[model samples]
Target: MFDCIIVGAGPAGSTAAYHLSNQGRSVLLLEKKSFPRYKPCGGGVSPAIQQWFDFDLTPVVDNKVNRVRFTWKKGDPVETELDTTEPFWMVQRDVFDNFLVEKAVEAGSELQDNSEVTAVQISNDIASVTTSKGKFDARYLIAADGASGAMANWLGFKEAKQFLGAVLEVETAVAPAERNTAKFEFGSLKNGLLWCFPKSNGYSLSAGIIRGGKGKVKDLEKQLTNYASELGINLSQSQFYNYPMNLWSSERQLHQNNALLVGETAGIADPLIAEGIRPAILSGVKAAEAIVKALAGDRNALAGYTDTINSEIGSDLVLAQRLSGLFFQFPGIAYRVGVKRPYAGKMMSRILCGELRYADITDMAMQRLKSSLIPGRG
Candidate 1:
């Protein structure tokens, strides 16, 4: 039996495998899809994630964006140029995930791709996983499977709240000027927002309904095509993809017996911005740490993983949820009063980059926007 078995080779699973293997533990990394498989994502990630690994990650980054442009219904643009030491990184999920897995392999973890897990059971402190390829056993198991995956339910966790999100990938050559800018368009759809991020050769345009609406979540074709037209882009070469976003809705236990949930299976995506990769990586590292402790005879180590996540990142999501409700409700007013301010965009970017916290501005922002809508509630 391996020391640990990690399901799903996304950012979370690969990260856990890397850290665990580097610490001299045997790890088995499993992926349902083949290497370099395409994923529907915006591909924007924080540079702050470099702190988790000791290796250089520049080889996997496609572009570094330092400018943020915001618009309302594809008009009235407000731009912010970040002055931080490291700009946000844009990556293709296929290359990025494969690179992470390669790092784990180099660190002594075994990777098994195109192996779908058919069954999983934990009994007597042992995890028995049966996949399409074969059956495996491990001392501990991590369910890093995504939002649509069944690992969480099989392990007996509550169903995480899922929201609709869509993406359009256009592969036309991009101008150098547009390659460094990340654009966000507000007020284009009901209970949602749209964003377009630049890659080295092309762009990823995406949309999502953030504040709990099921009305037109799946009807994103109209929203994205119209937005693309406004930006003077042709959609003839665009590849459309949609997926469910499992945002971090509430704090809950992340461990059961010798199994733990990471990435979307844990419902750890950001509710406000729909950022998944950064937090996913964070959970992976923390889960590895907990399992290592469990092997060393810490009875409460697995439970500690849940507490660490709640205190370190989950609390901020609560503030993000509050802000999301008010912002999407009065997006126009919030845009004019909040997103247009000189320092507003910078603060939001800093929060996504892990350099700032929602606590620093959520109260002030909610009060400001609430007063704008209510007229006399100060």
Candidate 2:
């Protein structure tokens, strides 16, 4: 029997396995897909994740984006140059995830690729996981199988509110001048934002509604294609992929009995930008820490997981949810006041780079707006 059986080999699962194994816990990491499999993502990661890993990630980093261009309805763009000290890094998820799984293996975690988890059950103090390869029993189970994973449903965790985001990753030569820049387009859709991110060879262009709805998938595809055409690039032959972006909610349970949910399964992604890497990794580490404490005679360790997440990650997500509603509901005001304002754009870039939090910047933007509205108050 393993001390911990983790489902999924993505960033969250792999990070949990690595940390657990490093502490001498017997960890079994399972993945539904083989290594280096393509994952649909904008692939933008802030440098803040550097604090989680000890090794250099230069191998997987495809580009360092020092500039960001924000546009509203394909109108005049507001561009901002990021701080020289810290810039956003982009990577192909396939390469980056494989690298992380390799690190988990190096840390003594047993990885089983192509092993799809079929069922998960927790009885008393033990968890039983049934996978395609075989059955495994462990003291604890960590679910990092992403938004569509069934482990959460099988284990009876409260359903999280999910948002759908789509991406079209294509390989085409990009000019040197445009290679290191990232672009975000607002007001293009009624309920979503569009993005074009630079990759090593080409770009990943995507569009999706922040709050998901049916019948918009095809519209997102058309929007992406039209946007690409405006930039003089054709995505007719490019590979297209779509995935759900799960946003965190206080009502969702993080741990139930001996089973714990992490990553997108737990809905920890940023609601505003739909970014998942930072929250996913942070949740993984925190989950491991909780399991470690639970093993060390603290029976209530798992119970505190939700509280910890609420304090650290949830507060920011709550603010992001509010900001998302405000921005998307009033895109024109957001564009004119927030995006067009130099200070606001700089703060936004800082938030994107993980230099600042959404709560901080939201307050700053509100203060700026107040100052602009009432001149004598300043």
Candidate 3:
């Protein structure tokens, strides 16, 4: 029997399989889509993620971003700049994810693409996975199948909470090279953020707009047109990718029996931005490390998965959820406030990078609120 069966070959599953197999464990990776499949993402990677995985940008990066802009959804579009020593990079999901899986393969993980897993069961300390190809058994099973993870749902685990109803993403070319800044629009969409992340060849335009539990494609298109017009960017020939934004704060439980959940399966998205890739990759690696530790004599090693993930990601997500609610409450007002309030934007950035913790954020927010409340303190 294989040591582990990792379902879904996204960053999480592939990372897990990579680490486990590198340790000489027999790991099986299954994916429903063929390699180089498309993924709906904002595609921005913080500098911290590079250090987290010892990632080399030369392999999969599409562009390096040194600037960011945040505009109010319904308020005046004020911009902020951070000329940091480090830069955030963008990569196409297909290239980035395929590269990661290839790394896993190089490390010895067996990958089976275009293989959709239909069922899974645990018996006698082994998992029997039934996929389109056939049946296989493994000592452990990891569900990294993403937002609509069938395995987690089938197993009755708590799924990622859908905060914003729908997300509209489009890729197109923006002519002016000077406007190559990642911009976040805050005021127009209620409780959502619209963005334009520049790529090497084009830009990825996206928005998380709540549509009363459903999304309107036409309305989203109109909004995109308006945003583009404001920026003087043409998008008549843009390619679009639409998907749901499932944020994973307040995640209930992730582990059960011999099954462990990672990535979107564990609901690890940023509630504020609906970002999940970096966290998914980080959690996947941690889950694998946890499993490795467990198999190496610490019976409680597997039990540490939840603890480790929470310790690494939970706090920031909580704050992001809070910030999401605040911004969604009144996009215009919040965006206006965020422009002069560098801390607000910095908090968002730091949270994404895992440089700040929940308690730290809570204290800072409370202090800021207290200061604002004091007469003449501002």
Candidate 4:
């Protein structure tokens, strides 16, 4: 028997394993894919995430960004240069996830890659997990699998609201080669945004629509090719990859019996921006802490984990849901105007960076929007 059995060694699972092992607890991390396998993502890391890990930029970062371009169909695209020392780092997901797992192993956690967990059951304060290799038992279990996580279903968690995210990313040799900026095009489709992020060797472009319809990489191909043409560039020779966008909130109750949930299995992705890496890491840490505390004497340790996450990230998730819903509802020129406004952009940035709490904004806006009628309120 092990102290803890963690399913899916992604950001959340690795984070929890690292923290638990650091505290002298035995931890086992299971991953279905082989180590260093490619995972689909936007490949952009916020500067804030550097606080958690000792990021060796030279080894993984493709480029640094200090400028952002925002565009809309109503007018010419506007570029904003944020003259700050801080730069957003672009990294490949395979390298990033492997680095996180390596840290956990260094801290004493045991990792099992290419080990598919087929079944999970919790009884008498112990979790029995059956993987392709064999059966293992542990006092605590964490489901850190991605959006299609089977563990969530096994635990009877409700399905997330469906949202479509289709992105075709590729690196191509192109001119104007200073890869130091990211471009975002808005109002292209309903609840959709297009992205262009530069890497050290080349540039990557993506077009995506969330919650509008099923995303097909083939359909995105034309959009990306058209965008490249407008920039006087061609990506006919680049390597292409696709990843799904899962931006839904998991049910509030993430714990049942004795099993706990983390990462996408817990619905940690931000609904508005579809950002998950940072939140997944934080949730993993919190889950480990809660389990540890509960083992020491708190019988309701899993419940505490749920409360801690809700307290820390609940308001943000709420605001994200509300804002995404509002954006999708309007889907017009006015929405683009709001995004281009420097104040709105900064406020949104603050929320994403964890510098501001959504509850504070809610309290302030309640008075102004109260008369306008709010959804979900009778």
Q: TM-scores, in order shown?
A: 0.98, 0.95, 0.89, 0.87
Residue range with the least summed lDDT across 10 consecutive positions in model 2: 369-378
Candidate order by TM-score, highest to lowest? 1, 2, 3, 4
RMSD of 2: 2.2
Per-residue CA lDDT of candidate 3, range 126-153, in tens? 8899999999998788998877668988
lDDT of each: 0.90, 0.84, 0.71, 0.72
lDDT of 1 by residue, 156-211 (tens): 98888788899999988888889899999998888888999999768899998787
Q: What is residue 276's positional error in candidate 2, in angstroms? A: 0.8
Clashing pairs in 2: none
Off by over 4 Å in 1: 215-218, 376-378
Q: Rank the candidates by lDDT, best first.
A: 1, 2, 4, 3
**Candidate 2 versus the native: TM-score?**
0.95
The global Cα lDDT (0 to 1) of model 1 is 0.90
Clashing residue pairs in candidate 4 (N, C-alpha, C atoms within 3 angstroms) = none
Question: Top lDDT: which candidate number?
Answer: 1
Once fitted onto the true fold, the runs of candidate 3 whose alpha carbons sit more than 4 angstroms away are 164-176, 209-218, 350-359, 366-378
**Model 4 CA lDDT for position 212:** 61
